[model samples]
Target: MRILMGIFVLAIYGGITFYLGWNLRTWLLAIQQFRWPIAYWIGLYAISFGYFIGKLHPLLTPFSIVGSYWMFFLQYGLILCVIANLLIAFTPLTTKLVGTWVISVLIVLLIVGTYFAYSPVIRNATIEIDKPGEDMRVVVASDFHLGVLSGKGHLEKFVQLSNEKNPDLVLLPGDIVDDSPKRFINKGMGDVMQQLQATYGVYGVPGNHEYYGNEMKQFREAMEKANVQILMDETILVGERFYLTGREDLTNKNRLPLSKLKPEDNALPWFVMNHTPNDLDEPANLGVDFHVSGHTHKGQMWPNHLITERIFELDYGQRGKNDMHALVSSGFGFWGPPTRIGSRSELWVIDIQFAK
Candidate 1:
C-alpha cells in the first residue's frame, strides 16, 4: 500500500509537470535562439530547489526569494495555463490560434495571480463566548512565511495592522517564519515584531514549516527576540479568564494528545491556537470556546483551496459546533509566486466579546 501510494504521488506530480511543460514548450522554443533550452529547464528546477539550500545556511538567504518565485512561476503559472487551455484543446482550432490563446491565458493568469499574491486581504470576524468577564479582542495572524519571499516589508505591515486594531491579544497560529530563522531575524523581523502592541500579549505556535526547515532553536530564538511567546503543548491563563491552549504541530509525533495538553479545569473558556485545522472534532468536543489556527493558507492559491477544504473541518473562515468556535485564516503572506487567485491573503481579526 505504501509503495502504491508513493507511485500514485509520483504519477500525479509527473503528470502535472508534464502538462505544465507542454504549455511552456512554446515559450521555450521562442527563446531557443538563446541556445540554452536544456540549461534553462535545468536551471528552473535548480532555482526552485535553491530555497532549501538557503534554509540550510544563513548566508544563502538571498537566493531563497529568487527560488521561491521560480518555484511558483513554474508550478502555479503553468498549472493555471494548462487548465485554461484544456477546453480549447479538444476544439477544432489551427495551431496558430491555439498557441496565441494559450499564451494569452497564461500571461493573464500570471499577472493576476501575482497581484493577489502581493496584496493581502484582511478578514474580520466577531464571536461571543459565555465566559463571565470583560470583552477580549484577539487578532490572529498566521503563515506569514517571513524569511525570503516575505521580508521586512511584509512583517512591518502585519505588525502595524495588528497593533492598529488594538486587540487585547495577538495570536500567531503558525508558520510565522518561512524557513531560515537567521535570515528572518537579520532582515529585521525581530525588530518589526517588537513594534506589535497588544493589551495582553502576542502568542504563537509552531507549524510544520518550523519543523520542516529543521531550525527549531533558531525559530525559538527569533520569537524570543520578538517577544512573542511560542507555546508548545501547553495552556496558559490570560486576562484571568481565558485559558489559551496551544498545541504542538501534528508534525511532532510525540506531541501530547489534546486530552493531555488541555486545561485541567475545562470550566474556564478556552482559546485554542492550533496550526492546521484538522481533526477538530476532538478539540471542539473538549469545550474550547474559540479555536484559532492557520496553515492551510486557504489553498494559498486556487483549486488547491479545494483540496484543503476537503481535508480540514474548517478550511477558511469561521465554523461552530456544539459550543466551540473555530476560525482558520487563509494567512497574511503569500507562500509562493507572490500571488493569490481564488483565495485572499488574510489576517483574521476576531472580536471575542465576553457575555454576562
Candidate 2:
C-alpha cells in the first residue's frame, strides 16, 4: 500500500512538472525565441525534483537546498499558469501578455516570501490554568530543520529570540533538526544553542524528521552536549511547579500513550510536547492541561495551509478542548526551501498563569 501510494504521488508530481514545463516552454518560445529545449527541461526537472533526489543521501545537501526552493516556485507557478491559461482561453488576453504578468508576479512573490521565511517573528499568548504556581513565561520554538539549508545562523537567531524573552523554560516541540542533524552537529550549532537562557532548562521532543534521519543516538548526544534535554516517552517536573511530558513523535509506533505517560498521582498542571497535532484527542481525553506541537509548518507555503487546515483541527495557533489548551507553532525553520508564503517562521512565547 505504501509503495502504491508513493508511486501515485510521484505520478501526480511528474504530471504537474510536465504541465508547468510545457507552459513555460511555450512562453519562452514566443517571448524571447528561446530555443534550448534540452537545457530548459534539464534545469526545470533538476530544480523541481532535486529535493527528493537529494534526500536519498546526506552528501547531496546542495541539491536538496536548491530543490527545496522549487517547492514554492512550483506551487505558485502552477497556479499562475493555470489562471493565465484560463484568462487567455476565456478572454482576448494574449499568451505573451499573460506570460509576462505571471512571471512578474512570481518574482514579487519570491522576494516577499523570502523575507517572511528568513525573518522569524514572535507570537505571544496568555493562558490561565487552574493549577497553583507562579506565572511562567515559556518560549516554544519548533521545526528548526537545522540541516544544510538551515544552518547555525538560524539557530543563533532562535537562541537570541528565546533568550530575549527571558523565558522560565524553553521548549522545542520537535523537528529541531532537518531530516538529519549532520549540519547542525558539524557546524557546532549545538554550542550556539547552549546559549539559550531560561530559568528552568531547555527540552525537546523528536519530530518525524529526526526519525527519518535514523540517528537518534547521535542527535541526542549533540543536544545533551549543548544542554538541551531530549524527552522520549519521559515526564519531568519543573522546579516542582509543573509536570512536562514529552511524547515520542508519532513516528514511533511503540511510544507510550498519554494515559501511561502522565503520572496518575500528579496534581500540578501537566504540559505535553507532542511533535504532530494529529492525536490531539488523546491529550484532551487524558485531561492534559497544556499541549504544544509543531511539524505542520502551517503549510509553510501559500494555499498549502489550506490543506494542513483540513488535516488537523488546530493546524496553527491556539485552541482549547475541554480543559486542555493546545498551541501549534508554524515552526522556526523551513522544510525544503527557505521560503514561506502564507506562514512566517515563528517563535511562540506563552504566558501561563496559575490559580492562587
Candidate 3:
C-alpha cells in the first residue's frame, strides 16, 4: 500500500515538472527579443535534477543512507543557484543568458559561504512555571530531523548549544530522527544521544516521521542510551511542585484517558508535551497548566509560514486558554531543500519559578 502511494506521488511530481518545462519554453519564445542564454537553460536543468535526486534518494536503502547528507548540501546549492537565476532573469538590465547563469552560480556560492560561516547560534527563551521556591529551566528543541538531512555534527552542535543554556530539563517535541537510526549505524545516533546533558533529564515523544519509518523502538533505545526519557501517555512529578506529562502523537490516538489524573491533584503546575498541537481544546478540560510542541518549523521558509499560521492556532509562539499556556517552537532543523529562507533553527528555554 505504501509502495503504491509512493509511485502515485512520483508520477504526479513528474507530470508537474514536465508541464512546467513545456510552458516555460513557450513563455521564453514569446519574449523572443531577449536572447535567453544557453547557460541559463543548462543551470536550470542542473538545479531541477539536483532537487529531484535530493527528494527521491532516501527511498532507495543503502544509497539513501549514504547519500542523505550529500543530498542536503546539493539541494541547498541548487536552490541558491535557482534563486540567483530568477533574480537575474527579472532584473531590468539586459544581459546574455550566460551572464545570468554566472551570476546565479555566484549567488549559490555566496549562500553556501554565508551559511557555513555564520549559521546563527540557537536562540533561547524562558517561561516561568507556577512552582514555588523551586524553579525548573527547560530547554526545548524540535524538528532536529537527525537522519540524512542533518548528521552527527549537527546533533553535536545542538547538544553544545543546549548545554550552554544549562537547562534543568530538555524537551524534544518530535522529528528528532528524520527516518530511521538503523539507516546510518556508523553515524552513531546512539553516541549522539549519550552526549546530551541535563540535570532533571531529557524527555521526548514520537513525531509523524518516527511513525512513518516504523523506527520508534530504535529511536527510544537511542534516547535511552543518551539517558533521555521517552514519555508516552505518562506523567512525572518534578520537585514536588509540578507534573510533566507527555502524550503520544495526538493524531494517532484520539480521546486519551484523563481519568488517571484527578482534579484534586492540581497541587503543582502541569506541563504537557505532544508532537503536534491538535488537542489544545481537550487538554484545557484536563486541567493542564501548559503545553509545548513543534511540528511547524514556522514553514522553514517564506510563504509556507503563512500557510502554517492559517492552519494552526498556536503555530510558532505562545498562547493560552483556561489557565493553560501553550508554546510551539519553530524547530531546530530543516526538512526539504536544506535551506531556511526565513525562520532560523530555534532552542527554547523555559523558566519555571515557584510561587511562595
lDDT winner: 2
The order by descending lDDT is 2, 1, 3
- Model 2 residue pairs with clashes: none
Clash statistics: count for each candidate: 4, 0, 8
Q: TM per model?
A: 0.87, 0.96, 0.75
Measured by TM-score, how close is model 2 to the native structure? 0.96
- The Cα RMSD of model 3 versus the native structure comes to 5.9
- Candidate 3 TM-score versus the reference: 0.75
> Between 1 and 2, whose lDDT is larger?
2
Taking the tens digit of each residue's C-alpha lDDT, what string does model 2 give over 1-356?
99999999989998999998898888887798777788888888887889878887778767787888788778898999999999999999898999999999999999988899889999999999987888999999989999886788888889988888999999999999886777888899988999999999999999999999999999999899999999999998888878899989989999888888887645798999999999788889888999999999999988888899999989999988999999999999988778898999999999999998
Model 2 residue 239 lDDT score: 88
Q: Model 1, residue 120: what's the lDDT?
A: 72
For every candidate in turn, the CA RMSD to the true structure comes to 3.1, 1.6, 5.9
Q: What is the clash tally of candidate 1?
A: 4
Judged by TM-score relative to the true structure, which candidate is superior, 2 or 3?
2
lDDT of each: 0.78, 0.90, 0.68
1 or 2, which is superior by TM-score?
2
* lDDT by residue (tens digit), candidate 1, 63-131: 666766666666556655655576557777544456556667766876887777667767788888877
